[model samples]
Target chain A: MQTHSYTSRRELETYHFHPMVAALVPLAFLLLQAFLPKIFPRLLILDLPLVAVIFFAVARRSPIAGTITGTVIGLLQDALTHQPIGVNGIAKAIIGYAASSIGVQVDVENLTTRILMNFVLSWVQSLLLFLIFRYLLGLRDTHLVWLHELVRASLNTAVAIPVFLLLDRVKLRE
Target chain B: MESFFSRFKNQLVLIVILLVQTIALAVQVRRPVEPGHPDAESVRLLRYWASSLMTPAERISTGFGHSVRGGWSSYVGLRNVRAENEALKKQIAEMRLQQAAISEDALEGQRLQKLLDFREHYVASTIAAQVIGTSGSEQSRMLTLNKGYEDGLKTDMAVITPDGIVGKLRLVFPHSSELLLVNDPTSGAGVILESTRIRAILHGSANGRVQITNLTQDSRIKPGEKVITSGGDQVFPRGLAVGVIESIVPDPEHQPYTLITLKPAANLFQLEEVLVITGTQPNLPGDAQQQLAADAEKHAADVSAERLPSIHDGPATEADPSKPTDETAPPANNSTDLVPKPKPALHPDRYSPGTAAPAAELTPGSPRPATDAPAVEPVRKTPVAPETPKEP
Candidate 1:
């Protein structure tokens, strides 16, 4: 059996990524999110952008960086959609910040922690989107089906596992 | 101030980001890009830049995927080619017989329409475009087309497949356009039931279902009834197949209104190529000259048939002057009261050569020529008439 060490906040290590990796990884995810479902519509259940945001935010462990990453990626995702811009931006920015803050407090390097973080944060991201769309934007048609959202978050979590592992190879120990 | 900023830098950044996005959202919500006034410049520019940045990669990926799939399907997937081809040939033969029958009906319809001076809008021109990507959000339900403003696409242009209507162009950038699918929550179309002719507004639900709204429970709508565009909204042409009703249930939110769900006529999820309606022209009398001549010949034969003693004797007994005589009466098979009339010379000002007649002049109950024979001289030949099959 493998053993892991619990690190304190001060001793927790933050990771850096190559500038090309940082930029291109999210772009690739966005492209996949936009185009892949055209071939296999069932792939729509996978939130690739959300997985990317969570992975990068948790890896960096910097709230400001996570917030900015979330904002940029969320706005880009919004631009591809017909809906009013910033709905995804707001949801993701908050999620990014929260994910990073959690990253700082906990040893996110652990497998179980990463899985739980992704699942919970994925659900929270959906909830934030629902609240923002319903309350702030007054999009009365936006209704959240709990079961559908649960499936989405679960699929996102499943995708995040392999995506985070692949991305971790690109992370530079800072 | 510097120390305070340093103490709450992350929180401040988050708040500022959220605030800016909220303000932008408010601006968009306040000044939506309504039809004919798509002047939300900043948002449009942002979307344009984003699409431009992403379009090349999407196009390359889409093209590569298509090439790979085509190669595999063309070369390796030949399991039942002979059987499928034979079946298709049989279907074509059956359809040819049906086409002959339909052609006669169409000619009769044209004669009646000319008699009443009825005009209708038809798809005049279309641009074929490839579906490259999607909005990637279930809530938005938009498609990204490879063609754009440079391809002569504009907002609100109807996008359709041979099977049925797909959507309308929502945003046109330089090299790409966004198509708001009919199943998007924000999308709506004017539709009518085929059998009952009950008109209603079609709406898209949040769960990506197309539905008809604003009908009471007492409405005689049934599942499997076909729905078609009414052309009242001016987006889609009249009689274009929209979808068929899948199910009907009472609306829980809106009292007394039934929620009628529709199964889209087009395979919206599997769309690869679609035709954008670039232009439409009103169906005019001179547009169907070939049909008119054929109908005129048929009417002459019918008159000759009616003059026979056995066939003419039955209606001659009750022949009132107000009713049509044997010479003017339609064929025995046709039940329409409209008599084929000789077409009058089109007004030079209203239907000049190389010009289209005004649609308003052909409204129902409009003044029509008094002649009852279906013979008319061709005024002008349209190079690309609506009846002509276009190669996409």
Candidate 2:
């Protein structure tokens, strides 16, 4: 595992992305996330924006760029909802920064790593939303449905594997 | 100092971004956009920007999808067409029968209302809007309509379908608007159980289920009983179908009220189009009201004589105390004769439209009113005055 991590890290040091791809990919994911649910309601369980954020952050491998990208994408996602814009923004920003920082040390390109990353990040997002809602906004409307969320996390991971593979082609590598 | 600043710059950026968002959230929560207020206009402007950017794409996509689906269904889906058409015909026949019965009842209700001088409010004009998109989040349940301020839609206007109410228009943009669905956690409506007519507040839960709250535990509400808008909220018109009670359970909080789950009459999840009520008019009395009044007058004229005090056929002011009480009886002087006068036929002019004469004057022996006297002939036989016996 250590040897594999060193090799992927060395590869990451050389990896880079086109700026337009960085911008448009996240926007496309946001649009799809918003649009697909209207066609098939069951698709509501999949958080495509979060998947895009994780993919971008890990691919960029720069904490600062990942944080900024997450913030912009999160706010855009917020714009599509009726919720307070910042809740998703804050959560995604944290996820983006952490994923990129960890990406520097691990091989998130592995399918298993990608799934585990999404699974853990989904819970983290929900927890942060709960805290912000309870402490900052004094809202109690969102309940912690552990089982539903677990299923949602697994679905997000499953979707991420294929979506990331498609996105990888569009990504420009050094 | 320079090394320290460089080292913490990324962390500082994250902190700054988070702080800015936090403030934005706080500001939004502090003065949330409400319908009709000028302060809320700012929020509408923001929504307008967002919707203008998004809804055009949505419309194009939906239109394209519909065309594609339509083409496929028209040619490739012909196998069940005949069976479906026959089923639809049968359904139409059944609905026509129901419509006839309902129209009869509505006529009767209108007649009764007119008799009591009751006024009603009815939808005067409405604009049809297509459901283009949703709020795209579970936290807020809302839909976007294809009509907006240009279409004369304002905030707080009622939106409904033939089956039931959808919701109220919340935010209006130039070309589109947002509707807060009735099942959102923040939504509440004054609803009445159709069976018992007991009123309660219909509240939306976070899980997208709606329930009746504030009904006393003793209230007998049956499952499958319909719920309707009470017009108490002044948002939806009264008597519009809302939903049906699905179940009644004790309040989990041990409160005095029971909780009732409801199945919405409108297919909230599958809405395609809705009617936005633009204006309402006061319902004026129709022919039904006039017919009711005429019938009442006729009834009163028929029974007036039996209900009034009897008087001799003379001027109403000058009463003869010795006169027999019954209109048919002859004068008292004819005690030996004991013969009664012939009863008069009912006068045709006795009861005219809008005129209700005093009951005593309507009797057979009484002279008709001067205006009607020329048209009425006295039909009763005047008894012959008893021949004087004084000479004998």
Candidate 3:
């Protein structure tokens, strides 16, 4: 078995990313978040995208690519939201990089590890986004977005094991 | 040498891309999809082209997509279509109910306009122009329109809507023009109570009602009294319906005038269109002469300015370069923002400085506002509440 480590930018770029799949789930999360309030009426600030972002960073193991993904998603989010430009972008980038760094440093290559990592990381991401948007950016609309993020993160963590197994095709790989 | 060539090649590509994007963006910005934007011509052209080119498959897909969700909704929405149809039928009935009322309103508006037109038609040779754009500012309500010198619009010419007087012409361009709405803080209308014949000054307000002030307490003022432009100055024809006097009250200073409140007939927001009455028909020959002079003035202004509109809507003012201009008609000094949008079919050659955006010049008629209301009154007036005396 070749114990290969991806260090070059080209190697990273050329790698089998399945960009559509990687980007699609977060977009689905965004769509769900948008429609959920209309359908459910009671659901507010469900941070499904935040959870999906964390999953990309940890499971995908690509900080740079994750940051790029975050930027595009951030732009889309900004279009949907009234927040100032670059606020969401910076928050998303920080979340992506932080999650990627954690995955690299730790020996978290299993289902349980992925789930736990997603749970913890999503909370951190939510806090940072709230802090930046609320305190730094001076947009204190409601405490709901952060709260919904926490609930969504937990929900995401619960499904992490099954989703990772499916996405990574771990069972087939073995 | 090789490195330099490669660098130049990359730089050239970047520059080319930037240049193309800039041109595209400028065109796109000039004619936004919205009404009052300058690029309405483009929007119309695009819509026409798109409508013609749309494939049968695409139309099918769109129709299918809409009905699919309705058909498969969790409740089996198709099953409830009959009840849904009933609700829609009820709505249709209400709409039918309102249709007569609306048509009556339209008829009234037409009559009012015709009356004003009959009077104005003989004045400055008025060209009927539509109000195409409105400045978004609440304090200085200005309207940009699609007619100007090309359409025989001139400064000080009267503009009016179906409801009542809009405002006099302020600035003129070849293809577009700007009018100061009557509600601006700077706006003052010479008006009189049609019922009492007591002359009172009607002023516009922040909230959407006109207030008549400076009336003596001795003067009897009551609600439902008709107010009209006094026409003492002979500028506004007398007996034009301004609004009814809503109330009367005593002032602590014992000011003689009661605060008479009136509502304008025109719902400012609902007006997608307006008419510019440019004086009378006999004035047309003189109007043509003055238009020549204005064109000359614009030419001089263009020569002194650093640049002019990059694109041409039409060759309406192609000979303007030869016209003589007033050397002293000062070029607009160091404007903080960009020039008004390039007006096409409206003014074709007009430029409203600082009031309109680049996009306004290109679009003639904006779509009706997306809101249930067109605008919260294009002109906001405040109803002066009469301070009733407390009976002992």
Candidate 4:
């Protein structure tokens, strides 16, 4: 066996990857969400990055990876753009941790089981987001608060079934 | 130990966010043209950099939307070509008649203004890009212009058109910029009356209309008076075509000041191309504000008189109390002599051309004190009796 200098990073002979890629995965979805709408205009949907984050959280047995990724992506969004700094990072981290906690208790074998868990996750996320927007953001009588919840919940729930089944092709377990 | 680092890191993030947001709010809530504080540059830079990527994309989308709108307008124009042409011909005829009255020498004076050399006053140092898109959120209004630092555009440049003022630059980036439309409440432009030469503080009323507030009620501002900048505000050079004062309403509730309603000569919804002015010199237009009022008076007469109440310069008295306010003075006149004697005119604006008939029925100002002026006190006591006699 070759002696390794780095403990955190390793070359994979099979398909197992480091957790950072798992974190950066949502970045692709985010860029796609922002870009696709401009091109097609009508296909613009909601909660792409968040949905991806939740999916990875449940798929990855280790909750630590999702939480770390969420924090990184959140900070990246804040730095790259003009938003309240750290706000996104905090929200994403919390989301990641929550998703992973739920994931830890669930059975990974059944396809329908994953979909139901995703549906429950979407509803809980939507509700939490609405409260955060209303109180923390002070968006009273704001359409965005209700809109974020309703639109994201429905869209993620619909999108969740397909994504979970497809990712099921590759097992992500110890 | 495990929880401590995580908690501390989270706290640090919160602190940083709070610090940045406070700075942004402070920078934005300030007067234009005043060179911003040191922190403002960073905020501007941050906003520009953050929005830069989406700016071009936005501009393209906005441009496409505008093009679609323009296409729609042209389609509408084509549909109504016959009637529109007839109206245009009528307007052309009016112009021709006006031309015949004014000397060719005078017409040349207006058209010959070297000040109008758009190239010099505003060095059209354009970055040669188009508007990509526009997006507005509930928190703020913004326009995504494709030109930015790459186009040599900076923050606080004045934006206008051949028609008049539109807005000023708020946020800029490497590839895009944002514009503030004239109707935001926070948006202010210092303007001068084309008439009395008095300066009025113009504010956007959040809706399309603009409010020129805190002007003294006694200001000789009249309807249809033109308003322009007085070369004082550094943000907008003096004498740009800001807007026309459509109506001047005295705020009875405000006590001591009047709020004038300003309508921008340029319709933002109808803009295809615009001129961005860089010059700081404000030149007074030898404009015919007096003439506009005369023409508008005729237009006003054609409109039904009742609509004037809303457009009436100043807030309407909202009291509408049930209690009477001393108009109950009874006429001691012989039933045959209820006619009121004519008095001098109260206000010219209050008297319309249709006043010819009403002018006959009641004299302006004095109806010869209605003969019952002294007896009005007794009439108040016997309100029922006055009606009984009038019924007789």
Candidate 5:
């Protein structure tokens, strides 16, 4: 297998999704994120919305598109929760921008690269959430249990493997 | 300038988006949209739009799953129906005898309440709702119910299961309402220990555990004591089961208070159907029941004095009433020297007939009652003896 290094903007490959696929895929993931935990609570560790955000951001490889997608998805996720409607928005926005920028430079199609990117980005998202809640929101009671968060990041990474593969079938290379 | 903007448009867009969301978050934190408060239109609209977009799919999915599970269980999972039926029948026979004894006790309680001219609220009506979805994050333990404002669900309405109190309605939409579960870090309720009658505030922790707060370290709280709603918060009805105390340890953060862990009475995680209390009626026995009271008193007199304690006998007063008595006071443990005093009972005048005060008149600690209906009146207004002082 050969890995392509997209050092220039012209060499970078981008993917576009159909309008319906773009709208429904994240919506389905959001529904599953909110609905499935009712049956299997351990699934709470799997951040389906975050996985979807990362997938779209990396696949599209456009910082602007990724930013907007992340903002919309994160805000929707926040709206579902009782917390203030922008905590996840800020975290996912940054992650989206970063993931897409990374995608533009590196071979994100490689399985090992995708897994490592997801694992590291999950931690980044978790840290952003912690800072937003603690310092920005002034919620002193907000704390992070390292072990729980580690398991969460790992779970999201593991689930992202299958999710990325499935989402790959829907994208149209541009 | 245009060329400069084009040179780094993505960075500029990201900055603008982050700044906007940060500002929105700051505004929300500054003025949180509490239930029933209509000040924050933008935040409310954002949430409403999100709910509108998501709830239809959730309802359909939940309904389908329930239908499939119900069909399977009803048709295929009936291996021991005969043995279960016989066991239930035997249990019913035993419960009948127990019910008779409890009825007598209830009658006696009614008589005493009448003698004291005490009035209390009873659940008058409830709306059954199905849980459709959750917040999906551990930090916010909110459940979405199928019933909404259109179904007469107002914010702060107490939601309960058959087992115990679940939570209260936090946000109500046109088609669905959000339930702030008892274990959310921001949630709290007034609870009392059954054995000790010690009232304390139940708080949910970030770790999804329920714990009793505002309790002094010296309070003699032990494991396994049942916790019940104290009706002090005015959201939950009095006497509803809340939880059981699981453990008590000294609070490392607050020096004077002990961290008492609680095991919730309801299996909150596994709830499917819940009842939202819509209305409450006042229970007041009247003078026409004087004959009934006399009969109850005579029945009480027939029972051996040793078996039943007289209602007239209040706590044993010490020579110096201010000093803590060994039997009546909470024991001072090795952790602390100060014993927390019991909270005073709510003044009867607050709920007296015809007052019909607005929600603002309620104490700050109590959640405002949802409706503005007139204060309930007794069958007949008759003066009676003072209320029996409760045990400390």
Candidate 6:
């Protein structure tokens, strides 16, 4: 496997998590994303599955693995919804790939970097969905409330701060 | 070619995967399965897999929660049981008397229905299901129920609570299904004002609030007027409680249409268990007499919210039909709660001797009739009750 050498700022070591953690984390996120809203509907603003996709993608630093993870998780999220599948899958795939590719060069370990990445990626994902629903699908009512999106992004990023830290503890080091 | 593939393998894989998914989406959109029909095979399989993975965990957790609450209520608490039991007995006695009159009115209404050859659908059966999860996005307002294909749940089946209609079942898996809530922007319902009878199209806004549109400026609706399903959408049975009108404003974009906001009857966010209406059968003249007896028996059997008389189906005449009990009485003030108040009996003069006039014509600020008004009006007016046929 050929990995891109984007930078030499620091020695980069590959970390491989236990395969079960890799599988279970995403599954748990998907389940909670689907389940928590039933108990506290306001929690919908936090997209945990998207957060997990970003965390795993950055931690693994493998664009291929990240893209695949995004695809599966996104599809699973779509399956839980009534919308036509793949809208989320495509958006998450791009986010996963971008985060991982960025991971390869930039250091995502800094809390500031992690927060900024999640905030930017959340907007990107929302914009992608808004565009798909509006132009591609010709859905008339699909309009993005910029303020709501901004607030949601902030909330997701805030959640990602702690979530990424917790998830990091579960990762197996090289 | 090998060198090129190796250099951009990750990008190439991501593009390929996205393209495949896009194609699938295109296929689904192009051949959009009609609502209420089974989804496309692949989507159905995907849903089955997703539900199979998640619903078990949800069921276990929900069951555990229920057990704890039930245990607390049963063994750990009984202080108010005596007071509650005595109050319920009194309520039941009062309902028995009202039940007798409602039964009579139901029979007369059925005879009128048969006379007019009125073919209408009523909820024939329902399966109780626990709400286990949701779509987790306010944009996609959906609930996941624990009952599914194995439980005879089907797409487009009306889901409800004792308070009002919730939504329709959008998809069914083996052990779980998705409820497309009425608050979803994509959802639309035909609804009418309880007293005004002004029909309009109700659609969910982006923020999960329901509003009525497609109303002509000539339509007269008030803020506190109760909204009920008009049954024109063919999804919900006519006369089911929907919501209370919150406000009405002219739609600036659509010249002739007014925008009326509503507060839904059931607490959507607080849902735990709901009924999935499985089937509906039309009322026929042959079954009308038999249905009358069955209606009485059904009303007798279940003395809970299911049997409560609809406030929308006010007595045909303004004469107090029965003693106003807390359960049956409309609130003293409509603005007291967010839940739609039970409608009081319409003024006797609203429907004139021969022709019915629009309820908006009633004199504004005219004092409402006292609850203890005479209860002996002849059963001349056709009752608006739909709850009788819903039993089963």
The TM-scores of all predictions, comma-separated, are: 0.81, 0.78, 0.33, 0.45, 0.80, 0.77
Q: Output the worst ten-in-a-row residue range by lDDT, candidate 4 chain B.
A: B369-378
- List residue ranges in candidate 6 displaced over 4 A: A1-11, B1-3, B97-108, B283-392
Q: Which ten residues in a row have the lowest lDDT in candidate 5 chain B?
A: B309-318
Q: Put down candidate 6 lDDT per residue, A110-174, tens digits, no spaces.
A: 98899899999999999998987887677876789999999999999999999998988887765
Listed per candidate, the RMSD to the true structure in angstroms reads 14.4, 11.3, 30.0, 20.5, 18.1, 18.6
Interface root-mean-square deviation (Å) of every model: 0.9, 1.8, 13.8, 6.8, 1.0, 1.1
lDDT of each: 0.84, 0.76, 0.53, 0.56, 0.84, 0.82
Q: Model 5: per-residue lDDT, tens digit, B261-308?
A: 999999988879999999876762344246456655665665634332
Query: Pick by DockQ: which candidate is best?
Result: 1
Name the candidate, 1 or 6, with the larger DockQ value: 1
For candidate 1, write residues B248-285 as lDDT tens digits. 99989887889899999999888999999999887634
Where is model 4 more than 4 Å wrong at Cα? A1-174, B1-41, B62-130, B149-152, B205-209, B219-226, B237-239, B244-261, B268-272, B279-392
Candidate 5 lDDT at A47 equals 84
Best by TM-score: 1
- lDDT value, candidate 3, whole model: 0.53
lDDT of 1 by residue, A1-174 (tens): 754343545244788899999999999999999999899877877778888888899888899999999999999999888778899999999999999899888878798998899999989988998998898889876788999889988888888888788888899887
Q: CA lDDT of B281 in candidate 2? A: 62
Q: Which residue pairs show backbone clashes in model 5? A: none
The fnat scores of all predictions, in order, read 0.88, 0.48, 0.00, 0.02, 0.79, 0.80
Q: Tell me chain A's TM-score in each of the predictions.
A: 0.92, 0.90, 0.71, 0.69, 0.94, 0.92
- Candidate 1 CAPRI assessment class: medium
* Higher-ranked by DockQ: 4 or 5: 5
lDDT of 2 at A65: 78
What tens-digit string does per-residue lDDT give for candidate 6 at B40-90? 887888877888888898888788888998999996558788888999999
* Ordered list by TM-score, greatest first: 1, 5, 2, 6, 4, 3
Q: Could you give candidate 3's per-residue lDDT for residues B1-392 as a string of tens digits? A: 88876756533433444344335434544443442222334433432232222223223443464477656794687778999999999999998667645545544554676777744323344467654333322223555565667777766666666567766665565565656666544456788776667886766654334676677765456778777776654455555666666667664444654655666755554444667765544222565446545555554566555343322333443436677764444333334333434333332212224333456445567754242211222332667664543322
